[model samples]
Target: MHDASAIPDAPTASSPRAGHAKAVAACGLTTALTWPIHDILDPVNTVMLFLLTVVLVATRWGRGPAVLASFLSVGLFDFFYVPPRWSFAVSDIQYLLTFAVMLTVALIIGHLTIGLRQRADEANASAKRSQALYTLASHLAGAMSIENVRQHSASFAATQLHAELSLWVCAPDNTLVPATPDDAALPHQAGPDVARVMHMVHHEHKGVASHQLADSGQLVIALPLTGSTRSRGVLLLSPLRAHDPTLDRHRPLLDAVTSLVATAIERLHFVEVAHQHQIEANGERLRNSILSALSHDIRTPLTALYGLADTLTLIQPPLPDRAQEMSSAIRDQAMRLNRMVSNLLDMARLQRGKDAGQLPLRLEWQPIEEVIGASIQMLGMALQDHAVQVHLRSDLPLVHIDAVLMERVFGNLIENAAKYSPAGSAIHINAEVQGDTLEVRINNDGAGFPPDRLQEVFNLFERGMPESTVPGVGLGLAICRAIIEAHCGRIEACNPAEGGAQVRFTLPLGTPPTIEPESEGEDRT
Candidate 1:
């Protein structure tokens, strides 16, 4: 059989008054059992029975029931089981020891049992709190937005603690305000003191409670949403009461919730920044495509018009001197426009990796003087006002490159020098074979690029000077860079030791292909 004394009592639905009556009846029954077992009830047995009642009352019912059980045990022992049966009087002097021992044991047991049960209840509550925090953190970790996290957190606090809840977060602009409730369409606003506490928690990484708010009737718990070495925001919970005793007891759980929110907010922030960068990159690409189309479609007809005007100027028995001069001027201006359009098209092709002609380098042995003379002939018109000088090493080995593209590369560089330098300035072109590589430099005495603008000068459509004053659209240097780089070469610009800008490019050296020897006995030789 199950021992009645060992079983914990079920929770009672009785009022405090009715519970007192039930406890008295239980004490009376135990006294009666003592009377039957011993003709004269043993003081020790009465004491033991009284302790049992106190233990049951404390564990299941709490302090009120334990006090009632204590007093009832003393009364029952005196009336039913004491020396003078059925009376409040005792016949034996030793029976006074029985009464004293029974009452004292009842009081002591009531105190000790109540203290132990209170401690056990506290432990159970702490464990439940830890579990709640774990659940909240797990949910928050998967949340994507601050609003979602706040709503879930507030709902958890409200349901678990049985209180109305509100969460206040700090905005990027550093304003502390309460989050609106879902049920109501109205906005939630925090008072001055509440806002102050929220800000303090955010900046200091400290917790603040509702009582800290001066006029707020609700208990506000401010928990900091903090990260490693930084405080991100604050979580403000407004519970129904001035202070929920249970919430105070579970402060650690609330802190865990705040930490989870902080981590989620930081992750979302970086994700948003990355998304914005992608959007901007796409916009830049689209803009570049539009510019390329405008340059090509608009300039094709202009090139044909310029070629016709030049042909008409050379008509037999040319119309008049003035008319011929006007045609020549129109052709020159049209040619300039043609060059700008070609630059745009070339840049577009280079960017899209569609120019396969630039690959499969053709190597050959060619004299440096011959290459320089060809490039000068192509750019003779542009360099008419400037004096051109070519300095080549007598022992310079033949450099390897695509002859057609390399001529264009040299022509563009010399043209750029002439355009930037003064009318009478001397533009020097120098070439030499420098151990396994060929170095070519074009220098001019003119105002050099600003220190900060040196690198920017090579970007597509990036002009060294304003377009209204300077002639070209800044595509010359960019084309120069592209052509040189395609030849497995490098180019750079810097100020010379004296003054002016000097641009240099280097190409790797390659040996000429060997030719077959003729047979000595061949009569044709």
Candidate 2:
């Protein structure tokens, strides 16, 4: 909202129209005749004509014509109505006092009347500005998009200021990125120096004007768009003339427009960020639902297969050699199915944070080699055909973690490496302590992931090879991320220089506990 009294009224150009001139001439004629009849006409009547002439000058002829009418009234009074009529001499000194008092009164009244009129005009202009600002604010508040707001603002600015205007928004690097101006002939491209000037004004929350622009038949005014404590961008308005009074008069209104634009841009930016977060949350929920359905539908058949395989192995007569092979195949297939179900259930549990009770972290002085060996032993079947190499340092310190979850972390990574790579490819697992954290790298000799899918691969059900004929549901790496993040760690995937994908993760290393000295033995020392 704008204060009406703060707005400045613009001075209109002096009108030279003939009708106004004719009206002033008519009032001057009537006053000339009435001044000569003071002896026949009442003195009040003569004073009334003089006052009427002052009103005409003030309202129609302005200050110059009004002053001229005052002198003409004095001349008419002296030449015709004063003593010794039709002569330049006065017969009485008392009449001189009458002349002096009337002239002084007329001049004083004219000056005061003009001043009051000027003040009234100023007030009216101020009221118009307040209305314009209020209307602009209302229209912008209901805008649905930044484009709509920009267009509305641009048009309003041009119309109100009577100047060609352009708006530039700030890029991420705080550079002035100009919007496409409505006028194509005007240079829409802002140069490097112009951008620098705009940035300065935006940072300083000030206005910018240069004589270079003024001399070039164009005047550029950079008004900073600031909202609250943030500077949203800059508004560049180009007026036609260097001394355009209209533009100068509307400076406050322009500031109000810039403020409104800044507020809108900030509002729209937050709205977009919130919308994106909502989409991610919805996607996470849908992925969990699908995984749940898959786990339930696949587990029933797998349990039945496991039971039938065990029954076949215990046939009354020893099963034929071929039958035993078939039974073993059935059991292996059932185990693979069961592992898939377990992966789904584990993913659901990890995403929901339901496994917090199962993986209680116990801090102890334990060798990195021991933890690595435990993880490998659990993934033995998955890595049966793949050559696994460990590169653990002998002097590596023990890490504090939930031993069970850490094993699952390594199990998932190694399994993912194997699943993506061809059978017999070497899978290298290395752990090194680097500056207050332990960095683990799992590298394989398989075809690397597509560059575009590097980050997407971690999203649930998003596979590096979306159309691959692989057996898993693409939840392995996502589960790996959830568990690692739960442990206050970070993980990322990249293509290695050796033509395979490398998955790296970091875990913070706490101080290893020192072994307590053995208490004095119960046996005699």
Candidate 3:
């Protein structure tokens, strides 16, 4: 059960008639008590007792009541206590002075007492409002869903203001829909033509508007639900009791509640958005992992098939020309499939990266030219139609890198260049040490990457020439970027002003071990 007395009475507008009645009743009661003992007390003592009654009335009520009480006390004192009983006319001039002093003191005391009560009431009201807002904020902060916010806010309003309320949320299409309450703790205040009220609130952006709820035949108010960015919805509240004084007195608290509810609703909205994005991200990761595994598993069988096709061509008994041609075709197809599988595997590995806790690279110091040569040799027949040109500075420095991974990076770039360029075009490879970095450029005479899509080419499964007849899953450049980045290098694709696609990559030029000149016949370590 609630401690009803602890709940302070809300401040309200004073009624003149009610104040006057209270003042008369207080004066009458004081007169009746002192009449029997009029002779027992002197004039000064009698005045003091009446003044006390006036002060009590002022403290309990307000300025109007106190002022009325003050005048009534003076009139009653003059009529009964002054000489010549029951007469308005005073006989002695000295007694007139007494009446004058008594009235002045009572009025002054009443005014001061009323001012103090007003200040106290104002302070108490402020404290109550602050406590209510703090409690509402605490409840809102922990609320995770729209439903939780609605329930908490509704309960708080009903308890604090005795107001039955309903919440309406804005739909994505800017329409309002009722938030159905699940619990029966409080009654809903749905008004007829709720849409009209909501429209007015949204368009006006005003504080609050009053409307009659059809269900309860009570006055209901609509407050706009607004967040930091924009208005979200509307809140409807109806005082449970007819002509409820608490509603008008506590309008500020309701405004505060509206603000809190709007903020909570927006917060919940964004949380849901983030949750959806997380799900999509997880799904994408799972898909990539599955595809990577399938590609990796297919690579071994494709390699064996390619070897078998090549072996058929070199059979001990010379095969027919047709059989040889078929074997060549089989070997070419198998090789192409094997290359695709390798790209997929590299793409998967790079995508998963440290997220799967893979082993770190076996980094070693090696000559950059060696990695390039190994990459070209591995491509074998792929670059058969292209002329490969290697341009290395005479004093190029060795780079610290993972040799195998570096080979894969070079292989992917070379393969990409060969696949895009004309069959007989030259594929240029340039390498040199510039300052503390070793920069390498691979250029081919082909349609360069589109300007708009230059950056996107490095994204997994994104292709430079998406519409081209080139057979690939668009993982080559992406894998190249991953491998280069793993070595603390940077790779970029751009079209040279002179024409053709040119890819430039740079690796840090770390200090290499020097070979000490061996004494004659010394063993090598």
Best by TM-score: 2
| CA lDDT of every candidate | 0.72, 0.74, 0.82
- What is the C-alpha lDDT profile of model 1 across 66-174, one tens digit per residue? 8888877777777876657788887888877766766677777878887998788767656665666677777777777767777767666665554444555555686
Query: lDDT ranking from best to worst?
Result: 3, 2, 1
Query: How many residue pairs collide in each prediction?
Result: 1, 0, 0
Provide TM-scores for the models: 0.56, 0.75, 0.72
Among residues 3 or more apart in sequence or in different chains, the pairs in candidate 2 whose N, CA or C atoms overlap within 3 Å are: none
Candidate 2 lDDT score at position 306? 96
Give the per-residue lDDT of model 3 (tens digit) for 1-525. Answer: 122312454455556667778888999999999999999888788899999988998888667778888888888888898878897778899877877887788889989998898788778867765776687799898997778888878777766777777788787888777666443222355555755766778656675545454466656778899887777888877776666767667777787889899999988888888999999779869978898889878987998999999999999897899999999999999988887887787677776874565525888889888989999999898899998999987778778898998898899999999999999999999998778899999999998999999989998789998899999888888888888887788999999999999999999998998968879898888
Provide the lowest-lDDT 10-residue window in model 2.
Answer: 183-192
Winning model by lDDT: 3
Clashes of 1: 1
Model 2 agreement with the true structure over 302-388: per-residue lDDT tens digits: 899898997898888979999998998898889887887887887876765633344334545557677778988987777888988
* Candidate 3, run of 10 with poorest lDDT: 1-10
What is candidate 1's local distance difference test score?
0.72
* Candidate 1 minimal-lDDT segment of 10 residues: 1-10
